[model samples]
Target: MMSDQPNLVTTCTFKGKEYLVKMNIISGNSLEMSVTDKYTTEEWQCCYDANYIENITHKTGNFKQFDIFTTMLKSGLLKTSECVSLDLLTYDDLEMLRNRRMNGRNLCPSHSVHTNNVNSTSNRRYLILTYSVEFDRIHYPLPMEYCGPPDPQVLQGIIHRLEGEVERLQEQLKKQAEQYPTNNTSHISKLQKRIEDLSAENKTLSEDVRYLNKALSKHSNSMRHIGMMKGIVNSLQEQVIRDRMTSHRQIKRLQEEKAVLKQQHTSSETSCSKCSKDCFSISDSKCLLFTTKFSSLL
Candidate 1:
């Protein structure tokens, strides 16, 4: 129901029992009924006697106008803005309301009352008057049939069963959570220890790499120094070979000069002996000539 007006959920107390109901607009009218609960997955369908709906409607002035669930809502009981601030329907009010409207042939299929007994003449004529959707106003109608009231005691039993189920579910959840608490905590701690060990190993590997790099650099410098020394040694060896060859040439030249000096001394001595012999022969010839001249003078 589209309306700017606020809906009201009002509760009425009766006979120390509780029921929940809502008042909301449906098709431009107010509807008040027992609160709808979530459907159960179980194979059982919940049911209430039709007589209960008639008797309660006979008592409360509300929901008298419409017989069906939809019509009652359209009657506009919840249209009043005051309903917004009002509290939810009291359990008493909801029980009474449910007692009146929820059990008609429209909602429940198994009604046992005679059709003629439904809305009898005595039940009519001001049995209960409440707002009706018929003329968009209040309506008065008589009770038609009786499906017999709900056994309040049986309803209480159902509530008790539901409460027990809820308790069992809660206990199971608690036990399961307790069982694995330590296992989860220990698994997390082990993972943390493994991570720490891996980090330490990585640090050690990095240090080793740095040390190897330094050693390689020193070996490279030593190789370069050795290469330079080898070149210097090669140059010194070449210079020594050149000096030895020069000394050998000088010694050969000196030997040749000494042999020439010896040959010149021998030639000069032969020439001196030949000159003395010639002088002696000339003196003999002079003496012979002097003797001839002296004999002629005598």
Candidate 2:
């Protein structure tokens, strides 16, 4: 027959905290554990294989929380208030046992067994059974005791490991501090050399600017001198054209005076020749009359 109640109910201390632990056997002989925090009222469950109970009873298994609970039970740290026998036998095994007992055959000496009452609390009995069936293997009950605090020696070991880690970190910081000054000095020298080179380049650029300004001033004076020379050449050309026009008018007046004088000279010469001829004729007549008078006187 299957029961709804847990096969074992007990209390245990895990990691310095007290908790209520309940162990149940479900169908197929599987074992389950339910753990609850007494102060916080929080609960959780874990199921183990059927072989886990067998391993625990033999005191040989992978050590985990369940193993710690068993260890605490052996050390009288946890207590059990209710205990019941775990039914490990299958249906076939029970049927075979009944048939053998009915046939009047001698009963197996190994199957005959009884439960042992280990402790009592509040009018309750705690029983642990050891028996064997078809497999001929003996099963032992899980040990239990009253609840208590965790051991002090385990806490001391944790604190010692933490102190060693802190010392190692402090040594690393000291080494970094010792190396900083040498790196800082080399970096400052490189920056000062760069500043000096930039200052020399700036001085050379200032000298070139002064030379260009002097050359531009000389060019401006030369352009003004060329403009003054052009104005003088234009005045000289205008004076030469005025002198040529005066010389042409004087030559034309002298030619007209020479022509008038030549005409007057020709007219005077013609009058003089005619008067001389007339005078000669008058003289010849006077002479002729004188000769005739002389002849008459003779």
Candidate 3:
């Protein structure tokens, strides 16, 4: 029974002071009270012993919502056309008249529908709602004397409309959540890991570029030194070749001078040999006379 009932909130006047009434679930005619806001938890106060909230009484002894609505409906006071047809009342007056006539239910109105076929009853308002809606009054054949609140079928329709609204809102929320997917820790971790890997790779590439630049500089220096050495070697080779040519010319001139000296010596030796031959040809007989004359001439 409690599950079928919705918590109700409404304004009530107690001792000329407006207070809020929260019609909480009850057990065996006990009316529960909420003190979370207005009173301390230690107090835990309850004010009524009525089995049903519709039977609750206020300090002012004002008629309960059920009694008021029934009275107004019976008296034709709730018919808007009838209320407005009063020639003296303006629009504002009509609005106030309507509000006054409503008298608003003190507790959320819970009702049941009686099915004739099954002879069973079902709770009309099952959802946990705290408010009521303004439904269009339907024309129903009655005794011409406005009876109590209309048929349970009308309340059931309002309940169905409220339930439909709740369902639609729930579906829309589900669709919205599905449209924007959630981010899990693992996905975030994966992104962070990828970023870290890229950073490391970039650092390694930077180091490699640094090393390459240094190597290039060193290689360039080595190439310059090699070029200088090649130039020196080429100059040295050219100087050595000139010195060799000069030495070769000196050797050729010495060989030519030696040949000329040999030729002069050979001529002198030939002349000496001829003179010796002639001396031998003069014999000893003429030699003695010739030696005496030659000795005198000498």
Candidate 4:
């Protein structure tokens, strides 16, 4: 919901923490969250990643709008903003607000769904906000895109994850390079098998990189989750440095194999002009085998 007036704070309980989640809008272009834990009175500026938003909105669907999650967003989230305007509440107006509204942005779903006893109602604060958006501009707030600056230290986990993945790929490449393909009777089959292995490794590493990027892209999603991983990240960074050095040695080994293949190709050119066609085929296959391997591993 686009509030014409700036900052708003709402108290909420999520994952056992009672927090005052404050959202402030700076012009039409920015949104920032300042959260204060009620018990400890601690405050932090947070990051809410866009990919995580897609997971919540798509998986939860109407429940996202009808539940406490709805409190954070209008019906359409970053894609669209829709809100209802209501008249000011008189004291008696409070008696019926719950009965009249189902829009997700204004009221928490707990109030909407909790059953009442014979003479009592669920007693919770009813917040009704009236806001508007320009549909043509697509100005809905994207949490990370408009996020407030978070403390720089929050990035440690992401840096660790990236380094880990890069090192893992390097190790895999090093192992492949160790099994040098010689121009023997089994050379063709070995080269083909290595190509397939490298291709599969490339695909897997690419996917891992993409997933890590999504998880680390927003501090809001990672802050609570990353704190518990400090021990894990510390070990990973150390392993990455070792793998990088080993991978450099393996790369030199691959280069020696390439020089051997090129020299073999040169010798074959003059050895038998009668079998020139077969020699050319072998040369092309060997060149392709190494080129494909290097492009993917590097």
Q: Which ten residues in a row have the lowest lDDT in candidate 3?
A: 121-130
Greater-TM-score candidate between 2 and 3: 3
lDDT of 1 by residue, 1-298 (tens): 1121225333332234322223344444333233221121011111223355444555555433234633443233343332111222322333345456666435653233424434442222111224434434333332222222222233334334433533443353345344634224343344334434333333332232333333334467643543443343343334334333433443444456557767887888888888888888998899999999999999
All candidates' TM-scores?
0.24, 0.22, 0.23, 0.26
3 or 4: which has the higher lDDT? 4
Candidate 4 colliding pairs, count: 1
Per TM-score, the best of the predicted structures is 4
Total residue pair clashes for candidate 3: 0
Q: What are the lDDT scores of the predictions, listed in order?
A: 0.37, 0.41, 0.35, 0.44
**After superposition, which runs of candidate 4 have C-alpha atoms over 4 Å from their true positions?**
1-138, 141-232, 271-298
lDDT of 2 by residue, 181-245 (tens): 43243433333343333333223222222322333335666335333333333333333233333
If both were scored by TM-score, which would come out higher, candidate 3 or candidate 4? 4
Instruction: Look at candidate 4 and give me any clashing residue pairs.
Output: 47-220
lDDT of 3 by residue, 1-298 (tens): 1122324433333234333223344453443432111121111123344423344323223334543422332333222334211011223333344455455743432222222412321211111111222543321111111122222233334334434533443354345335523323343344334434333433332332333333334467644543443343344334334433443444454467668878989999999998887777766657888889988987
Q: Between 1 and 4, whose TM-score is larger?
A: 4
Off by over 4 Å in 2: 1-230, 292-298
What is the TM-score ranking, best to worst?
Answer: 4, 1, 3, 2
By lDDT, who's the top model here?
4
User: Per-residue CA lDDT of candidate 4, range 1-298, in tens?
Assistant: 2222225545555456665455654443344455444554344453344444344445433222223333444322232334523122222245444345534356543442343431332221222333344542111222211122322244454445455565556555566556645443243334344444444433333333333344455666564544434434445545545554554555565568879989999888767775887889999999999999999999
